[model samples]
Target: MTAQKKCPVCGKPAEIEFRPFCSKRCADVDLGRWFNESYVVPEPIDPETVIADDGEGDETIH
Candidate 1:
C-alpha cells in the first residue's frame, strides 16, 4: 500500500483536492506566507564575474 502524504501546514493527511495540503485553509495559509515574504527564493551573484560598462558607447564591458 502507498503511504499518504501529510499536509505541510497542519500535519494532517492530505486531501485529493488539496494534494499536498489538507484543505483550503492550509493552502491559503501557505499562500499568505508567500505574499508576506515568509518564503524566499535566493539567487546568488558573483561580483568578479560581473561585467561593467565603461561608457565608451560600446556593447563590450570591461
Candidate 2:
C-alpha cells in the first residue's frame, strides 16, 4: 500500500482537496506563516537578477 501524505504543519493525513495540508485551517496556517514572514528562502537575492519596474515598460514579471 502507498503511504499517505501528511500535512507539513500538524502531521495529519493530507486530504485531496487540500493536497499537502489536512484541512483549510492547516492551509490557512501555512498562508499566515508566509504573510507573517515566518517562512523564508535561505538563498540571498542576487541584485543582478532583479528588474526595476518604473511602470515605463509593458513587460510584466509574472
Candidate 3:
C-alpha cells in the first residue's frame, strides 16, 4: 500500500484536491511564502560564460 503524503506546511495528511497540501489555506500560505521571498529557486551560472545580444534581438553566445 502507498503511504499518504503529509502537508509540508502543517504536517497534516494531504488532501486529494490540494495534492500536497491539506486545504486552500495551506496552499495560500505556501504561495505567500514564495511571494514574500521565503522560498527561492537557485540558479547557477558560470562567470566565464558570455552572452551577446544579436542585432535581431536574439541572444547568442560569443
Q: lDDT: which is higher, 1 or 3?
A: 1
Query: What tens-digit string does per-residue lDDT give for candidate 3 at 1-62?
Result: 65799999999999989979999999999989888784454555655554443457645655
Candidate 1: lDDT of 39? 48
Q: Which stretches of candidate 2 lie over 4 Å from their true place?
A: 1-3, 38-62
Candidate 3 TM-score versus the reference: 0.56
Per-residue accuracy of model 1 over 1-62 as CA lDDT, tens digit each: 75799999999999989979999999999889888784454655667556554655866645
Q: What is the per-residue lDDT of model 2 for residues 18-56, given as tens digits with 9 covering 90 to 100?
A: 978999999999989888785566677877667665678
Name the regions of candidate 1 deviating beyond 4 angstroms: 38-62
lDDT of each: 0.83, 0.85, 0.81
Query: Which is the winner by lDDT between candidate 2 and candidate 3?
Result: 2
Clashing pairs in 1: none
TM-score of each: 0.56, 0.55, 0.56
RMSD for each of the candidates: 6.0, 10.7, 8.1
